[model samples]
Target: MKGKYVEAKERLRGSIAPLVTPFKRNYEIDLDKQRELIEFQITNGTHGISVTGTSGEPSSLTVDERITVMENAVKTIDGRVPFVPGTGSVNQAETLHLTKVAQEMGADAAMVIVPYYNKPNQQALYNHFKTVADSVDLPIIVYNIPGRTGVNLEVNTLARLVEDCPNIIGVKESNKDFEHVNRVLLYCGRDFLLYSGIELLCYPMLAIGGAGSISATANVEPKKVAEMHNAWESGNLEKAQNLHFELMKLNDVLFKDTNPAPVKAALGMMGKIEPVLRPPMGLPSKEVLKEIHQTLIEYGKDVQNTFDM
Candidate 1:
């Protein structure tokens, strides 16, 4: 198990795109488009693929929908790159079941978010994560997005979880608190695979020993996002920095509204998906949409001619 984990750790680092779950106009899971999206990521040089994550809108999906997405993601990925599915749900039983399903489907790792809405205390959080980790042999990457989750996984809590669960290997820090993340690496040790979930922090995180980003921007700019990491890894710091600066506008614009809305709109403009989001999470307004479209043009996405497609 240790040897297997060592191999996973090595392969799991890079631009792991947390894919937007493409939906049909009727809001059904478009499995065909899902497969296409995976293929697009692979062909465009995304280092890894994750499904049913924040960008994939797992909260909006039924348990069966999430599992179906994972199953398809596993088959479509087909060992080309590491597959990390967001298996954590607000419900403990559901988190366990989805994580176990991910394990059964041969996922390289499972990304479980800190439980949201209920806002459990740190001890409860630790207990929840430890239970999931113990239940599966799959490596776990804890997702910490306090903005969305309504609770912070304190540095001590993360440290404790790491000490207790050998399979809990990393964290995707969507936090904006720069000092907090620094302390995480400081206390948790540099070997911890810290990934930046915040778009603007992707390059900065790499500078601070982050594994890579599970960035939403990668949904639109897979090649460049992957190149940023590849450049950094290959000792081309200047190229990496340049790409970071170049990607800044698109990164900022995508989050101007909510997540996958802007992302789906951008992809739709590029003729990737239908830009359909499930109800209650609708498309961005015309103003935000215009800004997104303009930004994509500035970033050379060739979306000008494809918006209506």
Candidate 2:
């Protein structure tokens, strides 16, 4: 388990794009568009592909739909780079089942988010991860997004989980508290892979020895995001910092409304995917759409030609 953790720690470092699950106008999962999106990421230099993540709209997806996405992603990725899928759900059985399926389907790792709605205490959080980690041979990257989950997985609790679960090798730190990221690294040892799930913190986290980031901004700007990481890794701090600032607005725009909406709109304008979203999640507001249009145009996207409005 320790060896597997170390191997994954070494390989899973860089800009991992948490891909959006493309939906048709009728809201069916567009598997063909999903493949095209994956190819775009790979062609543009993304180091990894994380499907069915927060940006992928996992909560609204049925278990079978989620599995289908994972299967298609693995098949499409085809060993080009690492494939990590979001497998966690509010239900433990579902989480375990998805993780097992990810393993069976040849995923490089599985991202299990903290259970939402239930808001488990720190001990329960630890136990929840422990049970999943124990059940699977695949490396587990704990997804700690307290904003969505309603409870923060504290540094002490996280370090404890690492100490106890050898297969629990990394974390996607999505909270706004930068101190939490530093504390996790300080306590868990630098070898424990830490990825910034917050776009604005991506470069800063890497500067502090984080493995990499899973940026929703990458959905539209994979090259720029990959270049930021590549620049930093190559020790071009000036170039990396410049790219970070360049991407700052797009990151902000993505969450101006709820996630994936703005991003999906951006992709729609770029002709990468249709701007459709599932029920309970809708398109960006008119004001946000205008902002997205203008931003993409400024970013060199041909919004005038491609976006139908």
Candidate 3:
């Protein structure tokens, strides 16, 4: 491996928090809050930082908005940690453009998700990823979230992309199917970097040789999340496993509604961010909010006293 790719592979592991694109109540992009969130993640010991991924609501943001988030993240992170920005969209041109922007801005890696909504076939999937990978010099982490994309990235297809594009170094498996994730490392080789995107599988994936996670749960509990990875890597399996089971409820509640909504609400109750989500992605229901509030209290987060009943 080249020196740069080798360094990225080493540094990009662990709890890479897929950040929420914080918005004001009026639905404006809150860059200032975004920076604050970045600082929060860093201070709390997050291993790396990723923005504009599933948790960040990429579909809702304009191309320019995505670019702006990448620029902001690059500036704020400032070499403190590895930065991997979500640079994929359903449109090929947009994906290429955003990825190029990320590389130009000096991101450590670019996570290109499977083109959603189109439901492209394996060959098409291979082609789409290879083209994007070929377009940039940065390491590319193929994001396979079949649930949202309506198309699964077969292991063979991913293997082919890895073979074809040298820069395509790893995959972020947001998939729930453990078998599929197993096959990816099996076929792609144990050296292939697999980062878990599923909150529940974060530790298990590590046990199975995954590099780390880009978990949404990290948005609420960066310290513990990063600690889970840190513990496992440090050979403290018992501690890591305990944290894994400990985080299960938080993981469950955060996803009780669509992502970012529940996570945003949790952050809001904690007074970290405003807890506002964009249109078509509102705050969690009163019922879910109450559950989240109670969950936070149990988890020892200082949830605000003003939580509505």
Error of 2 at 73 (Å): 0.4
Off by over 4 Å in 1: 304-309
Tell me the tens digit of each residue's lDDT in model 2 across 177-249: 9988999999998888999999999999998999999999999999999999999999999999999999998
Q: For each candidate, C-alpha RMSD in Å? A: 1.4, 1.2, 1.0
Worst 10 residues of 1 by lDDT: 300-309
lDDT of each: 0.92, 0.92, 0.92
What is candidate 1's local distance difference test score? Answer: 0.92
**Pairs that collide, model 1:** none
Per-model TM-score, in order, reads 0.97, 0.98, 0.98
Better of 1 and 3 by TM-score: 3
lDDT (10s digit) by residue, model 1, range 1-309: 388777877889999999999999999999999999999999999999999999999999999999999999999989998899999999999999999999998999999999999999999999999999999999999999999989999999999988888888899999999998998898887888899999889999999899999999999999999999999999999999999999998899999988989999999998888989998999888888889888888887778434432
**Which segments of candidate 2 are over 4 A away from where they belong?**
304-309
Candidate 2 structure, TM-score to reference: 0.98
Clashing residue pairs, backbone N/CA/C < 3 A, model 3: none
